[model samples]
Every structure is written in C-alpha cells, then in structure tokens.
Target: MSEDIEIAGEPSPPPAVKAKSRARTPTEIRLLARGHTKAALKVLVGLMRNDEATPAVRLSAANAILDRGWGKSAQPIESGEEGLETVHRVERIIVRPEDAVEGDADPKA
Candidate 1:
C-alpha cells in the first residue's frame, strides 16, 4: 500500500543548483612568477613582444627577460665548504692619524 503524501500550500524547495566552475582569471606576472618561474618567463616574453602592452610594462618585461636569461644579479656566494674546516686571512689597514709628523704643518692644521 502506498502512503498518500499531502502537498501543503508551501512551495517545494527550489531545485539544487550545480555550482558553476569558473576558469581561473589570468594572474599577475609577479604572482605567477612565485609559482612557476618558467611560465612567468613566457608571460614576460609575451608582454615584451606585445605592442599593446604599455611601454613601461614592455620595458620591465624586457629587463626581466634579460635578467632571467643572464641569470639574476650576482649573489654573494659563501664560497666555502660547509661542515669543512677552513681558515681565511684578512688584512686590514689601520690609519694612524697620530703618526703624522708634528713639524709637517698639514693644511688642515
């Protein structure tokens, strides 16, 4: 036996909506750099080649591409073997103002 269902005056709940999937918006060149350097490089190259790109942006891209191609600015490399014993000799120049000859009337004197 089927039970009878009563449809009250209230309207039935709206149909479940399927969430829409949106394509990720294009990301900024800098932000893209953090995640994928190579991809960011491509974007930079594109920007450099694009005539529509602002002069500043194109210039920046050109600089960035050059930097990437030539490698980032020189970093002070700690040129030493880690966990290995090493000794370095440092020579420092000591200025002795008192050593000036007393009779030598320096212009400043």
Candidate 2:
C-alpha cells in the first residue's frame, strides 16, 4: 500500500493562484458628445485587447464612430413627405456643423 502511494512529479498550483489566472471582464465603455473621438478610439482599442467584448458591441461602437465622424444623412422613408421631415430631423440631431472643423481656421482666408 505504501509503495502504491507515490508522490506526484509536480504539485498543483494553489487555489488563489488558480483564481488569479481567471479572465477579467471588459469594463463598460461610454461615449458622449464631448470628447467623442478620443473616447471612441479608446473603446476601439479596448475592444481589440479585451476578449470579453462581444462582436455586436464592437460593431455598434464602430458604427457610432463612423456616424459621428462623417456627416451621413438620415435614411429617407417611402412616405416621402412626413418621412422626409423625420429624416431631416435626424440629420439635424446627428450632424453638427461646429464639430466639422478639425482645427483653427486660417485668419487670412
């Protein structure tokens, strides 16, 4: 019986060490009108690094960034009258003329 009870070649890691090896959850990312570009970039990088970010969330973030970066017009509806008004409203809300300028304009121009 003693001969059968041989010591293992390698010992198992401690419980705490095992727990520490577990994967971390990605933090929730948020972006607002202010600092939207920087925040979006950070979130993009985070999503690339973090295994926890779902494909849907990443796509949504990318879409948000593109929509904000470019002045994309709203989709027109088939109704063509009230639908057009709704589309205009969406364009007004999403697209900002102030945010269009990248930096200080030339005083000479």
Q: What CA RMSD would you report for each candidate?
A: 18.6, 18.9
Looking at model 2, residue 58 earns an lDDT score of: 70
Residue 32, model 2: Cα distance from true site in angstroms:
9.4
Q: What's model 2's lDDT at 32?
A: 35
Tens digits of lDDT, candidate 2, 18-99: 4456554443233234447676578776775566788887777677666667956698457755535432343445645566
Minimum summed lDDT over a 10-residue window in model 1 is located at 1-10
Model 1: per-residue lDDT, tens digit, 27-102? 7555765778778888899999999989999999998988868987876556587766556999998756677777
Off by over 4 Å in 2: 1-37, 48-51, 80-109
TM-score of each: 0.35, 0.33
Clashes (N, CA, C under 3 Å) per candidate: 0, 0
Model 1 vs truth, CA RMSD: 18.6
Instruction: Find the candidate with the highest lDDT and give its number.
Output: 1
